[model samples]
Target: MHFKLPNKYLKYGYLLALVPIFFLVRYYQSHDPEVNTGESFFPSCIFHSLTGYHCPGCGSQRAIHDLLNGRILAALKHNLLFIILTVVLGIKGYYYISKAFFKREVVDWTYNKYFSITVFVLIICYWILRNIATPPFCHLAP
Candidate 1:
């Protein structure tokens, strides 16, 4: 016999997948050394290592580690884009959960083209600025 989950139950499968991710992040929070300290199992950015230029995601691992440890500013310092997206995603998650569980009416922004374009532009700008060696842009380096 074959069993198919009902449509209403599909979302719960996604929640179950997040269980392992939550534990992994918790493990990283406590046991993982800072990625910036030059010792980590986390893979170094190949784009940066080979090119000697900061990639758009250069310090994201460190930022995630710091954010998990409640070091908000440190996370922002590592990757401003990551922090901004974290906040944006956090809000989106909150809204999704509230609407799903509580049956609240909500305007979903998930498919907004303008938001997508803005994020793409921001990433490209960040990738370029983070590689610059001059005063203001140098600080953008991870």
Candidate 2:
């Protein structure tokens, strides 16, 4: 007489829960005029309200928004690294989910020391270049 949920069902349930949250966030964004909720949320972007220097994740929101709105060029203009990272993360997430739910292993890339070092190097390089470079490279803020 006890109800037990399967792993797939739980994963889908979590996804469903996200739907209402997304709608609510969209509604709030649409309704609030003064609340700069998008790329502006990050204080490090050149276009944002922050007075100091730029942060590495500054233009990410605008990038995501532009990408979602079918403006690939504009999204790239905002933050190329952010967009690329998003795509990579999305692919990784899909692979992980499929493997977890369907018991099907798509790829056999192991996360080892080399992988960690590569990711760390990439992030550090991105951080240094974005902060020290000129306007356009600085534009890669997010």
Candidate 3:
């Protein structure tokens, strides 16, 4: 049995594209700053700074760093949405890459109107829920 690159350009291009992601994860791993720190090592979220509230993306940078450092619970504590999005996107990327490079027939993901609306509502709810500093909802804040 033998395997070969799908195409010369694609093979090199795919590997080259990964370099930046690799470096980004590496950077995060090295600079794992806590989300609630006064002296933030990572770039601050402008929305959070002006509003004194956690934006939908407030803790995503710290979440990524925690995830890279093998702190799954801490990562989730920072931003559950980022973790969920990463998993969803990883699955999609895997399917597309396998289809393109291995000649595998990957099933297409269908976009349904109801599903789209549900996701949109869920995100809005999550945003609102995290901002609520009461009971279980308070735990959602980073």
Top-scoring candidate (lDDT): 1
lDDT of each residue in 11-116, candidate 1, tens digit only? 8887888999988898778754553456546777899878899988888888888988898988888898888888889889888888877889888776599989
Give the C-alpha miss distance for residue 22 in model 2, angstroms.
Answer: 3.7
- How do the residues 28-141 of candidate 2 rate in per-residue lDDT, one tens digit apiece? 344332346574333334634555555556666666666666778987876777876887788787887788777887973535788678877887777768776578566665
**Candidate 3 on 21-107: residue-level lDDT in tens?**
898778788876764455545778797899888887878888888888899999899998888888878878888788877889877
What lDDT does model 3 reach? 0.82
User: Model 3 Cα displacement at 75 (Å)?
Assistant: 0.7
lDDT of every predicted structure (CA atoms): 0.83, 0.67, 0.82
Model 1: how far is 28 from its true place, Å? 1.9
TM-score of 1: 0.86
Cα lDDT for residue 85, candidate 3: 80
Task: Report the Cα lDDT for residue 86, model 2.
Answer: 84
Give candidate 1 misplaced runs (Cα > 4 Å).
1-4, 33-40
